[model samples]
Every structure is written in structure tokens, then in C-alpha cells.
Target: MSEPPKERVKYIDTNLNLPYHYYAGDYKALYLRALKDKKILGSRCSKSGKVFVPPVIASPETLAPCDELVELPHRGIVTTFCVVNVPVYGREIEIPYVVASVALDGADVSLYSLIQECAAADVHMGIRVEAVWKPDGERQGDHTDIRYFRPTGEPDAPFESFIHRL
Candidate 1:
């Protein structure tokens, strides 16, 4: 019998655009509303006294419903961070930026946000940073309302200050 030739497999590359709507519950709606005003709001748990930024409906630790809303300062400490060097889809910022976990003042929970206006090498745990808001007209009820955080030139926070957040 004669040998038969093998056929090679072909691969097809494609992209998909999915349109969908996200429903933000009352807690998130209020939080985003405050963002539009260039303000950060946190939810406080009466029992545990933990405050969550981007306010939550329930206490993360105890899972108890939280009802009190507290306004938070834009300034916070960088509890930890890492530099982004690799490019990935859906990234709006330029490559090599720093994403840090911040512990805002008066809030028990920490919020994660992009760190900017400083050298990546200069970023470190406990660095003080304050939000740089977008112009009033540019805000759209989102976290992006705060363009990014910049160095406040304040002394670094002691490890004990933000350890619980970690």
C-alpha cells in the first residue's frame, strides 16, 4: 500500500466584543456617587468598628450588614505595592506603573489603587500618598475619578500602623 500524506491543522485567531450591563446595588451606588464628587466613602460596622472604602453593605470580617457611611480622606499610606512591567490587555495605564494597597485614614480596611507621579523605585510600604482627582467635569462616578495617588512627602508610617491591614 502507498503511504498517505498527513494534513496539518490550522488555527484561527479572533477577538470578541461583549456588551453587558452591570447593576450596582445601593451600597455601591452611593459609593460611586461620592466618587463623582471626588470623595471617598467607607462603610462602618457598628459591632466590629471596621470601615470599608468603596463602602460595602456588610462587614467583610463578620458578614454583618453595615449601614453607617463615613467619608474618608483622599490621603493614605501605601501598605504594599508592586511594579507592573508586562503589558496586558485591558490595561488603561502605561506599562511599568505601581499598583499599591493603601490604608486610608479612618478606615479599617485597605483599598487597592494605582500609584503615580513618582518613580516606581521610590515607592515602598508605608509611603504617604494623596489622591489627585480628575477635573470635576471629567469624573463619571467611578474610581478613576481619582486619577492616581502622589507622594505627600510625609514621613513613612510605622509598620505597626498598617500591619493589621495586611
Candidate 2:
């Protein structure tokens, strides 16, 4: 005899509210706190000598402990980027803004950020940009303290300068 048809699987659409305290452990706490001063921080891998921005506790490449703190320059090179034509929720930015992987000076890893103060067409790999920070009084110990990165009009860095971070 033929078996009865199996029930179809179903998914429920539900919204759950989750609120909790975010604890930034030592490595990240230091990095976040430096944002208030308009400074960027990185953690150096003790074994590999690589510096990572928004510091990680360990090196992703070598799994070595990152125990040293290093200051990074807000000026960075755009390793790669894309023009966003779609709108982001809660952000009032005009469409077609640029987003990029910024390889800050003295850091081995790159940070992702919005690129502004220039036309999207002008943004390209190796373009030099610097952070635009919020006014000090409004600043918090958060990455948001840097409103965005804008063109510095310096010459573009050569591919060799940031290719590893890409």
C-alpha cells in the first residue's frame, strides 16, 4: 500500500526582543575607549608582529596572543570599496555612498567604514582618506565616534602598501 503523504515543514515568523549589557573585554575596551579622543588603536600579535585594528585577543592568522596595544593613524588607504545605491535602515545618508575596507597606517587588518566628503566615482582602491569625527562633547567610546572617512586628497597609496590587508 502507498504511504500517506508526509506533513510539510513550516516556519514561524516571530520577533523576539533581546536586551543585554555588552561587555567589551580588555582588548576591545581599550580600542573603543580610544575613539573618544579621535584616536584609533590596534593590538599587536606577540608572535607574528601583526597589528590588528579594533583589536582582537588573538591573531586570526597565527592564533598568537595579541598582548600589546599600538596606536594607529586615522589616515588610511582604501583597499577596496563598493558604492551603495541601496538605503540602510535608520541612516539618512543619500544613496550611492561609498563603503570601503580601510587599511589604517600601522594596522595589519582593515576596518570597514563609510567613505564620504567626495563623490563615489572618486573613491578607488588605494585612495587616501581620514576620519571625520563627531564633535567631542557628543562623542562616546564607540566606533561611531568616527562619523566616516573622507578623502584627504593625498596621493593614492600603491597596491603593495595595503594588498595584504585586502
Candidate 3:
């Protein structure tokens, strides 16, 4: 009698090393340039007076044209977040790091970034945070210029203020 054939493998789990570049258009190019100058810029919609970080050409919500690029404060509020247990391919950070969506003080929109300088357990929605920039000489005209966001001692935002918009 023939032995039962081995069950076929149903899945394979592995990581792929895919290198790629994000096509940055005019608006994004301007924003990325400002990073080299240690400035944070947001696009403002003339119609709604809403500003978006990592400036876009139009407002995602209202679909209004954003013609103005305004400098934004480095401080922002944590709108939401998740603790990441999986390690990044080349980054050396330990497992269980916090990735958060930060709502800059003046911008209506939020940008996602890493959270550091404190335990992951303490990260939460509405927590105030300030960007920790790489030293001037180390900046390379990219989001990497801002190493991470660290908690600010200031009070957390009132949920009502941001909750209404989200």
C-alpha cells in the first residue's frame, strides 16, 4: 500500500526586500524641500480654511483647492495610535514601538509618525507631543529629519476638540 502523499504546503510566510520611491509631485516636492530647512509645512484650503500637513494639492474631505503653504508648529496631539510588534526590515528599533497619527496644532489633518522617548504603554489619544528633529548637520531633506515625536509635559487635548472633526 502506498503511503498517503504529504499534504501540500498551503502558505509561506516571509519578508520581501522591495526598494521603491514615492513619486512626489509639485506640492509634495515643496513640502519635502522644507524638511531640509527644518520647517513643517501644511497646505491650506481657501474655502474651508483647513490645513493639511505634508501638504496636498486639495483637501481630502471638502475637495477644495489648497493654494497656500503654511508653516506648522512642531507640536501636535496624538489623534490615535497602535503599538507595533513586528520589526521593520532595516530599522534597529526594538519590537513593540508606537506609531501614531499626530494632529498638528494648526493643521486640520493628521500625519502618522513614530512615538518615542517614553514607554509604549503611556501613548494614547490626545496626548501632547513634540517633534524631535535630527541635528541640523544630520538632516537629509526627508521626513527622517524628524527622528520621532516625544511626549510633551503639557496637558492632553480635550477629546471634544478633536473628536468632533474625526
Candidate 4:
């Protein structure tokens, strides 16, 4: 019998490395502390009375350095969300999950994160959520320290309750 043509495999290489001199200011430290304790922290603008998570160093409106660090409630309500069926490079997660914007209690702005432990079909706008924190030793002082948010067994809050925070 004659030998059939052999197919050749192909590979592509892209060199990538962590950036040098990555800096996280005091606000980052505060965020880390919150993660360690299974709490959410936000910075409140003293003048405009606005709160920001991932705690901005300056007020988005007034452009002033934020002074007050407020610990937000673990519970939150989903403001918006999208189902992610495609995975990107360097992403350590499963497919078909929901990426949601959650407005934590007592904060003026919503934060973006993954909504896990449920089917993508189950995710919806205005669903109640709670932080699923990592164990103390597992925390790495970054947003991922919380792992992901899971559905909280609570009724969704009225839209009016969180509209202003958006």
C-alpha cells in the first residue's frame, strides 16, 4: 500500500512577562485588608459623598484625593451582566460564566467581577450577590483575592435603591 501524505502540526510562540516596578498605593493595601477579612472596601469622596470600589485614588467627579475608606457590606445587587462563553488567554476560569457589575451596599459605584457557582442562564440583572472570599492564606492582595461572587439567597432590591449608585 502507498503511504498517505503526513500532516504537520504547527505552533506559535509569543513571549510575555510580568511588568517591572508594578506599584500599588495605600488604597491597594486597604483593598487587600478587606479581602483578607471577607469584606469589601470603597473610598468615599468627602466633598461629593461618592464612593468607589477598587477604591480610586481620586474622585472621578471632583478630582480630589479620596480620604474616607468605607467598608461595604458583603451583599450586593447586580446592575448589569454578560454571559462569557469564550475564554481568553491567561484567564484561569471555566467558560459560560457571567461577568457582572455589582453595586455593594453603602457604595456609590458598582464593581465588575465574575458571578460564579451558578448556570449562565440563572444570571440576570438585579440578582442579589455576595462575596465568596478566599481563605486567609490564599489571599494575594489583589482583586482575585475574593475568588468570585456567588448568588446570595436574598431577594433583589428595587431598581430605585441602586440606580443612583450606577
Candidate 5:
């Protein structure tokens, strides 16, 4: 006699929900206020003559309390950069984007961020870059407040212009 027909295999899709607690602080509030005024803020080390963006609460080198706040210029130079092709967190960002290390004018250390409004192939070490601020209504305390830096129309800066910062 013929065997009974075999049963078909089936799969199940499960959706789960988890619960947790979260906390939010006021740091962004202060930062937002500063950006709204179109100022680039940094924490100054009075004894060492060092400054840090986002105003660190303490000096990284000396571990000393940072009490002085300095407003830095919006313009800076690209010390180095890399091209980004993959989307982060499955989120899409303009591909072939240049992520650069920029040393703001008059600051000792460089900060890393995207260099927008230009071809990635054209971005290079020592390119002069200028800050592109977001519209007044879009102002936020985060790095996006400055939007991005683009090649300055000015002539390429001489090595002397940014070597000291490096």
C-alpha cells in the first residue's frame, strides 16, 4: 500500500518587545544655546594653553578641571580624510562622502567630521575648508549644527598654515 502523503513544513515569525529605562541630561541644552548664537565653543586649559571642542569638563592631559570657555572660528583646514561608502546602522547617507579631520583656526587639536558639498575624489590632505552653518531654525547643539565643511574658494593653504596643529 502507498504511504500517506507527507505533511508540509511550516515556519513561524515572532516579534518581541522589551522594556527598559533611559535618562537624558542637560548638556545638549547648553550646547544648543551656544550653536544658536553661531559660536564654536571649546574648553580651555588655562595652564597648558590647550582647547577642546564640545568643551570637555576636564583636561585630558593634565586631568585638571576646565573652567574657561573659548569661542573658535568656524573656518578650519582638512588635515586628513577617508571616503565613506557603507551606510551606518542601515541608514543611507550620501555615498562616497569624505570624513575629514579638521583643525579649526586657532585650535591646537583637530576634530573629525564629514566634509560635504564637494566631490570625494577631490578631497585631500591640507585642503582649506570652511564651515557651512545650518539655517537658524535648524540649529542644534550637535555637530550637525555646523553642517559640514567644504573646500574654501581661497587658494590651497600652505603647509605652514596647518602643520603646527598637527
Candidate 6:
């Protein structure tokens, strides 16, 4: 006898409210707290001599634990970037802004941030930029404390200066 036909699967759409809380551990807690004061904190791996911004507990490249935390400057080079022309949900900024990988001075790894205060066309790899921080009272001890990075008008960084971070 022939077997009965199998049931066909149907798809349904639904929305669920998922509430969550994030807890930044010791290292991230220190990093986020520093943001409230407009400071960038980085951790250095003694073994590899590499520094990481948004400080991680261990070096990603060397798998070595980092105990030395240092403050980093806001200035950096735009190692790479992309101009956003598309819109997405929950986007707080307008389109046509440049999002870039910034290699802050003294940090071995590059940090990502929005590039502003200049035309998108003016943003290019190796451009020198500085963080534009929000007022101290307005800081929330988070990434939002940094409004954006703007051109410093300094000469572009030497390729050798930031090429490794890229």
C-alpha cells in the first residue's frame, strides 16, 4: 500500500519582547568607566607588547594575559572606511556618514567609529583624526560617549605608521 502523504511545513511571523541586560566584566568595566571621563584605556600584553583598546583581558593575537592598562590618545589614523548610503532600523545617524577603522595612537589594534565633521568624500585611508567627545555630564560610560572622529588636518599618517594595524 502507498504511504500517506507527508505534511507540508508552514511559516508564521510573530514578534516577541526579549529583555536583556549586559554586564561588562572587570576589564570592560574599567574601559567603559574611562569613557565617562573622555579617556581611552588600553591593555598591554607584556609578552607580545601589544596594546588593545576597549581593553580585553587577554591578547587576541598572542593568547597572553594582559595586566598593564594604559591610557591612549584620542588621535588616530583612518585605516579604512566605508560611506553608508543605506538606511537600517535603529540607526541614529543620517546616511552618507563614514564608518572607519581607526588605529588610535599607542593601541596595537584598531577601533571602529563614525567619522564626522567633514565631508564623506574627504575621508580616506591614513587621514589623521581625533575623537569628538560628548560633554562630561552627557557621557554614559559607553561607546556613545564618543560622538565621532573628525579630521585633524594634519598630514596623512605614513603608511608604515598604521599599516600593521590594518
The candidate that wins on TM-score is 6
Worst 10 residues of 2 by lDDT: 1-10
Which stretches of candidate 6 lie above 4 Å from their native place?
A: 1-9, 12-20
Off by over 4 Å in 2: 1-15
Q: What are the lDDT figures for the candidates, one per model? A: 0.88, 0.90, 0.89, 0.83, 0.78, 0.91
- All predictions: root-mean-square deviation over Cα? 3.1, 3.8, 4.6, 6.8, 5.0, 3.0
Per-residue lDDT of model 1, residues 1-166, tens digit only: 4755666557766788999998999989999888998879999987798898878888868988888999999898999899999987987778899989988988887888899889999999999999998997999998778888889999999999998885
Model 6, span 52-166: residue lDDT tens: 9878888878899989999999999999899999997899788889999999988888999999999999999999999999986999998889989999999999888898897
Residue pairs with clashing backbones, model 6? none
In each prediction, how many residue pairs overlap at the backbone (N, C-alpha, C within less than 3 A)? 0, 0, 0, 0, 0, 0
**Which lDDT tens digits does candidate 5 get at residues 1-166?**
4976587557777778889885423433555578878987777876687887767767888888767878889888888789988877864677868889899887878877888888899998788898888898888666668878888876676787777666
Candidate 4 structure lDDT: 0.83
Model 4 earns a TM-score of 0.80
Candidate number with the higher TM-score (1 or 6): 6
> Per-residue alpha-carbon lDDT of model 4 for 88-143, expressed as tens digits?
89997888878998898878889888999989899877789998878878876668
Those runs of model 5 whose alpha carbons end farther than 4 Å from true positions after fitting are 1-29, 158-166
RMSD to native, candidate 1: 3.1
- Estimate candidate 2's alpha-carbon lDDT, on a 0 to 1 scale: 0.90
**Per-residue lDDT of 139 in model 1:** 96
What's the lDDT for residue 56 in model 4? 85
Per-candidate TM equals: 0.86, 0.87, 0.83, 0.80, 0.75, 0.89
Q: What TM-score does model 3 achieve against the real structure?
A: 0.83
lDDT of 5 at 141: 61
